[model samples]
Target: MRTAYGVETVRATERQLMARLPEGTLMQRAAAGLAVASADLLGRVYGSRVVLLVGSGDNGGDALYAGARLARRGAGVTALLLAPERAHAGGLAALRRAGGTTVHSPAGGRAAGATEGAADRPAGGSASDPAERPAGGPAGPTAAEVLIERADLVLDGIVGIGGKGGLRPDAARLAEAAERSRAAVIAVDLPSGVDADTGQVHGAAIRADLTVTFGTHKPGLLIDPARDFAGTVRLVDIGLDLPEEPALEALQHADVARLLPVPGPESDKYRRGVVGIAAGSARYPGAAVLAVAGALHGGAGAVRYVGPAGDAVLARFPETLVSDLGPAKAGRVQSWVVGPGAGDDAATVAQVLEADVPVLIDADGLRLADRDTVRARTALTLMTPHAGEAAALLGVARAEVEGARLSAVRELAARYRATVLLKGSTTLVAAEEGAVRVNATGTSWLATAGSGDVLSGLAGSLLAAGLPARDAGSVAAYLHGLAGRYAADGAPVGAQDVAKAIARAWRDVRD
Candidate 1:
């Protein structure tokens, strides 16, 4: 599992580490890692021109120190101090000691390198000094912009954990210039202007080609928006003694593989686990067929279909035991999957919920059930609601759910007292206990009608196969998403195709 700690959590960890280490030890570790990464991006530090956008916090300090390192290694490094007077004293001294030049406003530009009288002034040095003063509107294009445009690489140290939402005027302008430049951008820690906890872009954020984070990963680096801006992420250990809660998580293929049910040789069909599926009706029997198709490929030993569409299910999957007595009489099952083309049938949904086994509620089931009853369930329950359905369940607008997916999923889980899977551009699975997992795979093409039905059945089957409610939900999502990608193979695919692709996905994962 890959972990992502929140900003506050990271700060706490930083504090703990600070207590044991030297005063500037963490910053030095961060700077050294950043310098090494910047060097890698430049290919060769020798003769390379590097620009450092220095802000007023530790972020700027990191850039300045890293620039110092590069300068000592034969690189031409320049520091564009946005707040020279407030800059980290140690970092500034290091940069100057290592032969890195500093640039200030036009009045102080000549000392850096500007004509006597130009619109763009050179930065650095004293504006009061007549010999160093430039006759220009200001400094030429701002030292940061000028150096960023000409340099081979740009280091963004504008904001750090201490910084708040959005960029200040100077930082924003510098970021814009860096974006337009040919120089590769390397962000220290996170890309500035992104909410480290929610992955929301506060304002214009620096889009980095790579971000070198220290100690652990930040939530924003693992999620979207901020994740998109953070092209690639690398972690640098700073030896922080953080607590467990600080280690937020993201699952990898190996982690999913471990959670998947692998049938043993001695396991019989009934011994493995049976899934009871209450889905579809005469009007929409295809939903039942699709659901069964997914259940068939899931790790479940058997699937029992109980609904008005049993005939269609039997015709499509003869292996499924067809029963008309409803979910109550569906016989013994380790888990039950409700909804998915059941078409607002409250009675059928109620019967499924009344079952003793763990249940997965989806589609119309999400709409037809009583919220309190779902919360009262003794067995494990998983609610999979797409944005629109989730919006209804939460009594909010669909746009609200889509806008803040993480919060929506968590709310749904807490409200239902079940594992909630909020399916969307970023599928989020949140447990009632507050554990959240984000699915990073799958193409946009997976958004076809009835695709969710397949996911519901797949998750239900995993539950029957004995994985915990949270694990089953997350693993099923991973499989379903992978299957969608495989089914599409770049083209549009239907829900049935996605169902068929689940078998292939299972093989891919198991093999």
Candidate 2:
């Protein structure tokens, strides 16, 4: 499992490490990593045009130091100072000593870069002083903007994890110019203007090509909105001794393989556990068929399905023990999967909640089931809701749920008193307690119709095989996402196709 900590926890660890180490040791380590990564990205350090957006913080120090290393290696480096006087004093001196030049994104500018923090002058520089001139240098901040536009790489140190809210007008304008540049933008730790604790992007923010985080992973790098702004993430270990518990976790292939249920020599059809699926209807018989298709691949020994689409389900999986007598008379099952395509079937949804086995609820089941009734259940209950469904449960707009997916998923789990999975760009599974798991798999093509139905059946089957609600939901999400990616390849795929690819995903994980 890959873990991420919130900004406070990271700060606490940083303080602990800093207290024991010599002054500036941590910064030097961070700078070394950043410089190495910058060089790797540039391929050839010499002759590379590197631009650094220097703010008044340690993050700026990190960028400046890295730029100094590059400058010493024969690269033409320029630092565009957001706070000319307040920039890291040591970092500025080092860059200047390494044949690097400095410019200022001074307040106000021509209408060209004036959207947010527009500078007053053109991209020019004041590097005429013997100690301030860059190699192949141009004069001042006006020239710096053009350097930014023509540079091979741009290091965004405008703001760090501690900074909050949107970008100031001048910063926003620079962010815009950075985007227009063909340079591969690399954020020092995190993109400026994004919340470090929560992955929320309030206003204009730097969208980086790669974010080289120091010490530990930040929660914002793992969650969305902010995560979206953070293109690809690369961790640079500065050796901070963090705590055991994490704020969030992502399951790797090895973790998933360990969680998978494999049949033993003594395994029998009934011994492996049976999954009861209460889904589909006359209106959408395909929902039932697709749900069973997924359940059939789940590690369950047998599947007992109860709903109006009994015939449709059995027609597709011939192995399912189909029943039209509802969940109460669905015989014995280790776990139950409710909702999906069951439109207006509140009674059936209620009956499944009373079962002694673990229950996984989805789709219309989330709408039809009583909130108090689900919370009162003694057995494990897993609720899966997309942003829209989660929004209804939380009494907020869908945009609100999607914007703060981590908070929204945690709230849903706490309020419903069950493990909750909020599906979207990042599939999150949160238990009433413990670190949340973010699904890093899947493709945009997986957003097609009936995908959730397949997810419900697979997770429910895992519950029958005895995984806890949290594990069941997260593992199922992992497999479902991988399957969707495999099935989609580079094109659109139906839910059934995703269902069929579950075994392939399982094989891929185990191998």
Candidate 3:
């Protein structure tokens, strides 16, 4: 599992490490890593042009020092100081000594890169949108514009992890220009203008080709919105002893492989656990078919399906044991999966809730199940809801739930006394307490019809196999995401394709 820490914890750890080292030892260590990462991206550094968007913090100092290293290695490096008076004194002098120059980008300075009465120089491209071609400044091309246009690399040090409230106007403009430029933008630590603790991005933020973070991964680097801005993240160890508990965690292949339930010599169909799938209706038999399709591949020994779509399910997967009766008469099952497309079947949902087995509720079940009764259940209850369903359960707007997905999942899990899985661009599984697991796998193509139904059956089977509510939900999501990726190798795919790919994903993880 990959773990990520929040801002306060990261800061405390850094302070301790800094105290033991020399005055600038930690900074130098970080600078060395940053410089190395930058050099690798630049490839041929001899005549490469590098631009550093310097701010008023150690983040900027790290960039300046790294720029000095590049200058020494025969690269033309320039520092665009957003605040010259507050810039790191040591770093500024080091740059000058290494034949690099610094220019103050005062708020009201002419758009053109000029020295007033000083020597005339070309300007880099004035800040603009990253997606467009480099547009010349109003007064033709300025020195700043020219530098940015010709630069092979740009380092973003505008805001550090400690900063708050999104981007200031000037910072936003520069970030936009850097992104618009042809250079590969590299962010120091986390991306600028992002909430390091919450993974929230507001106003304008730097979109880097890569982010060189120090010591450990920050929460923002792992979560979305901010995570989207942080293209690819590379962690550099500056040697800080961190705590075991992280603000967030992501399961890797090894973690999932260990949790997978494999058949053994002593195991029989009954010993392996039977998953009871109560889904679909007269109107939508496809929901039952898709759900059963997923269950067959989810490590379950047998699936006892009780619903209106028995004929459709048996047609696609004859392995499924179909019954026309309700969940109460579905015989014995280790776990029950209620909802999916059982539209208006409040009575069926109520019956499954009383089954005394771990139950996974999704789709219509989320809408039909009584909140008070669900909370009263003794066994593990896993609720999988997309943003819309989750919002209704929490009695809030969909936007509210989506804006703070981490908080929403936790809140729903705590209130309902169940494990909650919020599915979206960034799928999260949260228990009533502890750190949430952010799904590391998936493709946008997974957002098709009946996809959630497929996920419900897979997760329910894991629950039947004796995985706890949290593990079952998270593991299912991880495999589901990988399956989505495999099924849609860049093209659109249906729920059946994702279901078919689940076995491939499971085996790939084991191998």
Candidate 4:
């Protein structure tokens, strides 16, 4: 499992580490890692044009220090100071000592190459000093823009993890310029203008090709909107002791493999576990077929299905035990999966809720399941809904749910007193409390019709196999996402294709 912490936790931990270490030791370690990553991205440091967008905080310090290292290696480094006076004094000196030059932004009331020395401005020299001028003298408003466009790489330090509400007008212009440039943009720590804690982008933000984060992964780097802004993420260990609890967690192949169910030597059909699927109507019998297709490959020993689409399900998966007596009389089942295609079947949803076993709810079932009844259930309840469905449950717009997926999933879990799996660009599974699990193994091609029905059945099967509500939902999401990738393979695929690939995904995980 990969863990991420919020900004407050990171800052607190940093303070503790800083207290024990020498004054500038932490900064040096961060700068060393940043320099190495930058060098790797550049491929060749000598003779490269590197531009640093310097702000007024430690974020700028990291960029400046890293730029200094590159300068020592023969790169023509230029620090485009957005705040000349406020830039890190020690970092500025280091860059100067290593043959790097400084350029103030046009809005800074000085033209390009207004060299500021160690403790003074080139010893009685000023912006117009001929002794310390750049190759071309004093370019105008377009100076900063031209510099960034011509550079081989641009380090975005306009804002850091603490920045919120997006970029200011001047910084936004620089970001736009960088976007137009062919430079490989590397954001320091995080892309500016995104909420480091919530992963929300309010306004203009930097689009980085690679983001080198220090200490630990920030929640924003793992979540969306902000995640979309952050391209490839590389974590550099600065060695800070973090608390055990994390703000969020993402399950990798090893984590999912450990959570998978393995049958014992004495296991029989009933001993392994039976999943009961209550789904589909005459109008949407394919939902039942697809759900059963997924359940059959889900590690469940047997499947018992109850709904009006019994014939269609039996035709596709003859192994399924079909019944028309509803979920109540549907023999014995370790867990129940409700609400894929059963349009307006409130009675069936209610009946499944009353059962003493765990229940997995999805699709039209989200609309039909009674909120009070779900909360009152003694057994675990897992609800899976896409952005639109989750929006309806939260009484908000779909865009709202998509923008703040973490908050929306957590709110739903708390309100319903159940585990929620909010499916989108980043699939999130959250219980009322604890770390939210995120899954990014899915492909965009997984957006086909009846795809969610397959996920519901898979999760229900895991629940039946005795995984807790959170683990069942998270593991199901991981497998379903991996299956989607294998089935799609860079092209379009149907829900059945995804279902058939679950076994392949299972093997991939186990091995």
Candidate 5:
């Protein structure tokens, strides 16, 4: 499992570690790692031009120290200080000592890079100073913008993790310039202007090609919106003694493999467990077929499907035990998956809710299932909803749920007193407590029609096989995502195609 700590926990851990170590030791450690990552990105640093968007915080220090390291390696490094008066004094000294010049932008005007060791140089150097500008360089663009535009690499240190509500206007301009530039942008710790704890990007933020995080993974680095801004993430261990419990956890292949249910030789079909899928109305029969298709590969011994679409399901999967009876009389099913094109069948949703076995609610079930009944259930309940369904349940706008997925999933899980799997660009499974599991295997290709139906059946089967709600949801999402990848292979694919690819995903996980 890849774990991520909340900002408070990370800060607390950093404080404790810093108290024991020599002053500035921790920053140096972070700087060394940042420099290494920066150097690796600037392959052949000898002639590379590196630009640092320096802020007033420790992040700026990290960039400055890293810039010094690059400067020492024969890279032409320039620091564009957003707040020159408040820049890290030690870092500025280090950069100057390493032969890197600083460009201070005051009032958003053009400024030339100050000459090294020029004690009397104005805050913004004269544009006529040939020492800073390239000989006869284009005159219109600010020196800061020119430096950013022409650099081989740009380090975003405009804001730190603690800063919120997006970047200041001046800093925003630098970020915009970096985005327009051809240089590969590297953000220190995480992309600036994203909420570290919630993965929310409120306004203008840095979009980096790579984010070098220190000590531990921030919640923002793993979740979306903010996660999208952060390109590839690289974790550098600065040796802070973090707590065991993480705010968020992402299951890797090994973790998913361990959680997957594998039957023993003595196990019979009945012993393997049966999943009951109470879904599909006459209006939408394909939903049933797709659900059953996914359930068949979901480690369950058998699938008992009860709905109006029995004939449609039987036509595709003859192995499914189809019945017209309601979910209550669907025989002895270990678990039940309700909804998925169910169309307003509130009574059936209630019947499955009344059952003692674990239940998974998805699609129309999210709308039909009563909240109080779900909250009162003694058995484990897993509710899978895309952003829209989740928004309806919470009575909030879909955009709100999409922007703050971590909080929305957790809130839904708490309100329903059930586990929730919020599906989108990044799928998340959250219970009332413990670390929220984020599914990273998902692809945008899985956004096709009936995709959630397939996920519902797979997770329901896992529940029937006796996996806890969290584990069932997490494992199902992992396999479903991998299956989507296999089915699509970078092309458009149907939900059935994704369901058909589950077996390959299962085998791949075990191996």
Candidate 6:
């Protein structure tokens, strides 16, 4: 599992490391990694023109040191100091020693060329002056635009962890110029102007093609909004011994494979696990068929269907055992999946909830639930709510859930004391333990009518197969997303096709 920590945790870890290590040690490690990554971006560092957007803090210091490294290797490096005097003194000297040139803003009248040992020329230079030289002026768009457009790469050192949300006016203008240029942008630590902890973009943020983060991953780089701005994240180990407060996490393929339920050789059909599904009605019998289809493909040994659509399920699946009684009387089942197209059938939902087995509530079932009754249930419960359904459950607007998806999912889980899966562009699974996982698979084409119903049934089957409630929810999401991508293959696919694709997805995972 890949873990991400909040800004506070990162800061504390950095402080601890700084107290134990030599002065400037961590910054040197960060600068070295930044230089190597920059070289990769430029393909050939030698003779490459590089521009550094120097700010007033350690962020600018990091960029200056990195520019010095590149300059020593024969690259033409220019540092556009947003705050020349306030910049890191040690870093400035290092850059000068490496033959890096510095240009002050036009507002600060040109001083003697310290490193070159020559008197400073006038701003924009006279006609006799070399055309390759930089003429800094106010460090605004015009100056940054010219430098960025001419360089092969632009290193964004505008703001670091010390800064707050959004860019300062000067930094924003420089970022905009960098965006318009052809150069590949590299952000130090993170894309500037984004909230490191919350992943919220206060105003405009620099979009980097590559971000070289130090020590560990930040929560903003893993979650949305801010994550969208951070292109490809690369962590540089700065030797900080961190604690275990991870704000977010993403599951890799190996983690999913480990969580998947694989039946043992001694396991019989009954021991493998059985899933009972309470779904469909006379008005929407296809919902039952689709739900049962997903359960059959999902790792369950047998699926028992109970509802008005029993006939429809049996007609489609043939193998599913149909029962007239509700889920509570559906004989024996390891897990129960309630509500798909059941409409507002409170009686069926109540009966399903009364079952002794693990239960997964979805769709119309989420609407029929009483908060007290759901909270009182002793069995492990998994609630799968799309943004709209989640909005209704939380008594908040749908737009609110969509805006802060991570918080919404966690709130649902904590309030109900269950595992909550918030489905959307990024499927989020939250548990009562405050653990959350983001599913980064699936295509937009999976947005069919009954797709969610299929997911509900698949999760229920996984629960029956002996996976814990949280693992079942997350694994089902992974498989469902992979299956959706497979079924679509760049074309539109219906709900039934998605259900059929689950088998292929399971096989792929096993292989």
Alpha-carbon shift of residue 408 in model 5 (angstroms): 0.9
For 1-511, candidate 4 gives per-residue lDDT tens digits of: 8999988898888888887887777788888999999999999999999999877667778898999999999999998877676677778888889998887664342111212221111111134322223322344436778889999999987667777676776678788889999999999999988888888888788999999999899999988888989999999999989999999899999999999999999998788889999999999999999888888889899999999999999899999999999899989999999999999999999999999999999998999998999999889999999999999999999999988888999999999999999998789999978459888889899999989999998999999999999999999999999999999999999999999999999999999
How well is each residue in 324-355 modelled by candidate 5, as lDDT tens digits? 77887778899999999899888899998999
Q: Judged by lDDT, which candidate is best? A: 4
In candidate 6, what are the lDDT values of residues 1-511, reduced to their tens digit? 7787777787778777777877888788999999999998899999999998876666677898999999999999887776565556667777878988776533232111111110111112212213223454443456647878888988987677645657756567678878888989999998887767666677777899999998888877766667777889999998878777578777777888888777899987678789999999999898889889889888889999999998888878999989997676678999999989989899989888877779999999999977788888888899999999999999999977875777888899999998999898678889888888877678899999999989988999999998888889989999999999999999999988998998888788777
The lDDT per prediction is 0.79, 0.85, 0.83, 0.86, 0.86, 0.81
Of 2 and 3, the candidate ahead on TM-score is 2
**How would you encode candidate 3's per-residue C-alpha lDDT over 90-109 as one tens digit per residue?**
77767778988775543332
| Error at 491, model 2, angstroms | 1.1
Which parts of model 6 are misplaced by more than 4 Å? Answer: 103-141
lDDT of 1 by residue, 209-315 (tens): 99999888887776666788888889989887767764346677888878888888899888888999899988888888888888888878999998899888888
For candidate 5, give the lDDT of residue 394.
97
lDDT of 5 at 199: 96
Q: List the candidates ranked by lDDT, beginning with the highest.
A: 4, 5, 2, 3, 6, 1
Residue 143 error, candidate 6, Å: 1.7
Q: Cα RMSD (Å) between model 4 and the true structure?
A: 4.4
Question: How does candidate 3 score on lDDT?
Answer: 0.83
Where does candidate 4 stray beyond 4 Å?
Answer: 106-141
Tens digit of per-residue lDDT, candidate 2, span 145-253 = 6777899999997778787777887677678778988998999988988887789888788999999999888888988888888998899999988889988889989
Error at 203, model 5, angstroms: 0.7
